[model samples]
Target chain A: MKTVYVCSNTVTGIYSAIYDAWKARKGEEECSVALRGAVETELFCEYVEVEETVHKAQAVEALICRHLGREAYWDIYHAVLAADTGKGDAILGAMLAAKTIPDSRRIMEHLSHPKVEKVFELSRSVIGEAHFLKGAVRFRELAGGVLYARISPKAQVLTCLAPHFADRLPLENWMIYDRVHRMFVIHEAKKRWILVQDEFLDPERLPDLTEEEKEYTKLWKGFVHAVSVESRENLKLQRQHLPLRFRPDMVEYM
Target chain B: MSSSESMTTYTYEGIPQYMPQGAGGLRPSMFQKLNILADAAKYDVACTSSGTARSNDGTGMGSCERSGICHSYSADGRCISLLKILFTNECIYDCKYCINRRSNDVIRTSFTPDEVCTLTIEFYRRNYIEGLFLSSGILRSPDYTMELIYAAIYKLRKEYNFQGYIHVKAIPGASKELIQKVGFLADRMSVNLELPTAESLKLLAPHKTRKNILTPMRLVQNRMAENKQELALYRNAPGFVPAGQSTQMIIGATPETDFQIMQVAQSLYQRFELKRVFYSAFIHVNEDSLLPARTDEGPPLLREHRLYQADWLLRYYHFRAEELLSEENPNFNVLFDPKCNWALKHLGQFPVEINRADYKMLLRVPGLGYKSAVRIVKARRVGTLDFSDLKKIGVVLKRAMYFITCNGKMLYPTKLEEDYIARNLLSAGEKLPGEVVNMGYHQLSLFDDVGFSGKMQQYM
Candidate 1:
């Protein structure tokens, strides 16, 4: 006499649905899982469609906190949200699976669901960039009272990376935009963060370095070049560790 | 080799790394000199993590990553965070072993106090590094170099108001007062043995002796202890080397046996309470004929990596150097990791049930890292961890297979053969031909067996 609906996409939407399911756990309300863009129903069933709501989303956050403490909540939430697939089903499974808090290494294992796999990939990509940024990121000062850089990354990593800079440069204002992803994270340090989605802002092109910037850059480049050991020029190993793509953004390379 | 370019010639004679040599004056191009010197000093492997301490307060520069990663790479390829560099490449001491020996016609340079401070701050501010890891070749007398260093660190701290991790190297023969002063400012300090033994020092580096290196090392360790004792009840006490002191020894340069290296490492850890002992695979950077025939016998990297792995065991796993290496078996087994190798030789210690083995016991099993060891301990707190759970705990059972059991079930079913398991773990055989690996454990008799060399055992 009752109905079960089960196809939905988007981890947030999926979590939103499970949150709805928990609310109606004692209800005789018919259920259906539908994809974000799709709706299908059988003849015998009365379809109940649930849209994602912040209030409903809050319950999922609570469930995540309860099921997988604060840190694990983040691990699961981000990993699920990162997946490019049946985010809803993955959430459904992960919520069920998060019953026991796994150790640090096992936490990564839960990230393998097709829906949230992209998050693991994205997070790993960001981590990879942070490491590369360690050796290569170059900054040049602008006369207009700003420091800027041009970096081309292979993933949607700009958002994940803003905090490290913000923590390091608490007094300075800076903008790191993924020109490719078309969104940039701007930090005012001791203030709120802003992510710009404005279409009018052009990001790909930037101004050149000024004289002061050029001077500092030359010193760094000379240091890197001159310090490079003639006895051991393992360019193969150097390039393997630091890819050529990151060179343009690094002060030592520039 | 040319007669003038005698293979045994060190850079500069009469000056020791222990004795710094001059009335240190302000040098303008300190930054360039530091890069030249530190680049040369990079061959010294003592820069471990200066640990995470950020200066990102409402002002200028730096945040440290929790990974404690710094300039150097780990065996599994983890980068160290510290912006490690030397103060000057111009050393007066000519240790035949060193690249910056007065003999090599390499670039000579030194970073001034201001230059050192500025580079550390700039690199840190750009989020390019965590903090400074400054070591220096003694530009002047050890006292003079100490003066320049103290000024540089003082400026970085007081003038610059930098609260970042600062790891400074201690110049031997510098007064204990100087050592005490530098230790209070820096998070960590170091003294390089360069060579392991006193006899070896006499032969290879005439300007230095074991006494010169060990004296300062002991003084620093003593000062660190005295400060730690005095500060026991105080909050944020001015302790010396909060991260503790570390030292480096060039591997393969001296004829000292692996036994000798392990012995010195053991004592350093035991006596000085050192945090680390880095083994630099001697790169044939300078052709010092006093060195062994620059054969394929380059600084054994695999050996260095193994030494580090063993050092980790000694520091963390409660393994003593004597237990790990001794007169009878002075070298680590090249076929298996130190832990697994140990377990193989001491099979009576194996077949430890994962669910019941104590933390110390679990650590002795091959293939179990700190994580797995901790996992084994923590998991047992809940319910018993079976063989399957052991796998989930990330224990590499290949080497550990002979050692641990889960719910009384072996991950692999077999009566363990010592040689079989040892050979099993040495899977990377002949990948590079004509090499006796770092352990000095290789015996041609072990290699002569045709079919027995079918494959090394693989303990997960």
Candidate 2:
């Protein structure tokens, strides 16, 4: 019987499912994994809904980090955050390839393998989205002097962007709210940042920019307008570098 | 030209307080000043926002990271909008290629230090820019202009606590003391080598000489070297141009060949320890007989592209100027890129066995980039890589097919003949950037076509 472990789309959920599937030892052929909410339930197949357990997830994470190395572990970790529903299965495929490949630690570098390539493709896309958000996400100084920025990224990239801002703006109280994921990473001034998932992120509740913030925004608009050469104005090229989707949140475009 | 008396001086008092009337007699608002200064600054192409990794100290608003972030790309596909503006467009020198030459009847403007600081801090806070790339026309004497630049950046760093990457130009003929003072505050600094050679400098920019440019570059390099030593000894010794310095050479404005340009770049890297040598394609903005005719064809952008390709080969690929071009063949083949052209010339190096070749040898193969080569080196250790495996490894089999062998066998039966490979390579459509191809002029004209119409009639 082919056992398909249906898991939640989160990294912890996928790792938990991977742990349970490995414990069953049905090997590569009999057992498979699928991310819940990502795929439709099949009619006749034996489906196992893997429960989320921290211990199980930690064990699987430790095993991958130890056996396949940190690079592959991070690749799988970031790929898991991808919006693709098939990412869970891709991780399973990659883990299987890692077990079988001779130099298992360097399995991620084996791009010729379909399993490894799938993980890289997902990771690249997720990382690429996070990189764009790093440059594109604009913050407004709220009335309380807290920096507030909202990003409606396609990928679940809030966690990925948190470390960058935390490192760069260590003393600033800032919150990077992800609209799609209904999650946020908030860092208090000189304190550690924490990621919280809450569905109460309403645009109407966002405070207006302070008077200083308003002045800066106007000054920025003036500079941006002046900087572009009239003769060499190429909107098509500009669109290619910074796509149209990112512009809606940009202060200059707004 | 080298005399101190020859230098023109424009003091702070010498600058006009308001907008000099032209182009709509509206009172020059701050916005209008920004527009004119920014428009004037656009011709400069070196707007890189990389090199420094200054972290925020909590009090300030920004941080500079190692890899540069491009905020926006211009219509030419060049990165722009980095708060790149001239401190002032008022000039003393009369360089023929310059839009703000002394002879030109353009609107003159200057940004006060306080205004420049506010613009940089504000734009940075909004995430509209990576950092500031501040350049200027010679407002007065080089010393006076350099002093104004120093005053502006001094406020941005010390007053505003703005820690973002700042790339400022070190005005040639500025006193060494002022350049050093500004050097400590800036992340990166540059001196423009307006024209490639001394003779070209003499012909166009009568006031500026080759010495005026090279002197500041050498000064920055020396200061950066000293700063490195001091940094090693004292942890908190403020880094002097921590990102190092770069210089720009205007291409196609002068009659220098690719060979000469590459040699200049090669020597600059070896001698000066410069971070980058920017190549600006000459856009004919002035109506001087000394300048090239401005046809709709625009600048020699294609030639500039080829030179940049060769430059990468020099920096990363371990190739030299002499190897890529000689006096006999000083220009790159317009049909093929530098790498492929080299591969064709040295056909004996072809059919490198994929598994057996070292990392360096693999890099020379057509269609194999540094990343793919590194991947190949890593992947081959696990198992024998076949042709299909090579495809999955991101190797462009289209070009690499002629150059590499898998498992002691060619992917297909192929000849090592140059013309055969060149024909195949040509048919594959060189896969250059679209802008490069769009800027290209046809080498053969339809007007010069003899029997091409006769051949067309056969199809008709």
Best-fitting candidate, measured by DockQ? Answer: 2
Interface RMSD for all numbered candidates: 5.1, 2.5
Docking quality band of candidate 1, CAPRI definitions: acceptable
User: What does TM-score give for chain A of every model?
Assistant: 0.64, 0.94
TM-score of each prediction: 0.78, 0.89
Separate DockQ for every predicted complex = 0.26, 0.51
User: Comparing to the true complex, what docking class would candidate 2 get?
Assistant: medium
What TM-score would chain B of candidate 1 score versus the native chain B? Answer: 0.82
lDDT of 1 by residue, B19-53 (tens): 21223333335445545654675675554554445
Model 2, residue A95: distance off in Å is: 3.1
lDDT of 1: 0.63
lDDT of 2 by residue, B20-115 (tens): 333344446777788888888888878887887777777776787788777655555566537899988888999999999888988776777888
How large a fraction of the reference contact set does each model reproduce? Answer: 0.22, 0.55
Worst 10 residues of 2 chain B by lDDT: B447-456
